[model samples]
Target: MTISGSCFCGAVTYKIEGKLRDARSCHCSMCRKAFSAQASAYALVEQSEFRWLSGEKLLTNYESKHGAGLQFCSKCGSTLCGTYKGMIHGVTLGCVDGNPDIALDRHIFVGSKALWETVPEGVPQYEELPPENA
Candidate 1:
């Protein structure tokens, strides 16, 4: 399935040629600050399947000391996607143009989550990452 998304101002657009997986909401402080939200909802995609569709020059990136790279639109400051060591890590679900047929299957880092942020019932929660085999 091909997925499309863009920044708020349409300054940066992207296409993912394959399906997304490992959907999750990250509640760690770094994620909260990176997304400017209580948490960040995202799904991982292969770098080979991801590409910029337009306005690539308008994308500004920031790489954390831990090597997590985030891409934002310089025009609207919208968080578009995440990276690791210059490779595509995942796309922010909020930026997707339409429903991506996926939902957060895991709520991670609840131990470091904001006190006011309550994860809804039924979704799996973890203080950190789930067991690698989970």
Candidate 2:
């Protein structure tokens, strides 16, 4: 399915084609701090299939020493997505419009999750990366 999304201030926009892959929630500290939420939900899209539709100049990026790149809107500073090691690009699920009809398949880094939160029922939870690396 094709999906489109924009940042909080509409300073960044994009279109993604093909099937969304590796939908999951990240409870890692970096993700939690970057999103300022209990957890961050994302779907992996190939770098080639991800296209910036507008306001490209308003986008700013920060790279972690570990090779994870966080892209956000310069205007509102909303975290849009993260690109890791130039191989996989993860689009923040909350930034996508209209729900996108995709359910998060699992929760990763559950060990780092906030103490007050509970994993959703029936959704597989992993203290670390899944065995299949999904």
Say which candidate scores most in lDDT: 1
In model 2, pairs of residues that clash are none
Q: Which ten residues in a row have the lowest lDDT in candidate 2?
A: 79-88
Q: Residue 33: error of model 1 in Å?
A: 1.0
lDDT of each: 0.91, 0.85
TM-score of each predicted structure versus truth:
0.95, 0.92
| Strongest candidate by TM-score | 1
What does candidate 1's lDDT look like per residue over 28-121, in tens digits? 9999998889999999998999999999999898998879889999999999999998888999999999979888899998999999988888
TM-score of 1: 0.95
Candidate 2: tens digits of C-alpha lDDT, residues 1-134: 78899998887898888667879999988888888888999988888888889988988888889998788899999788888864448898888977677889999999899898887879999998898984
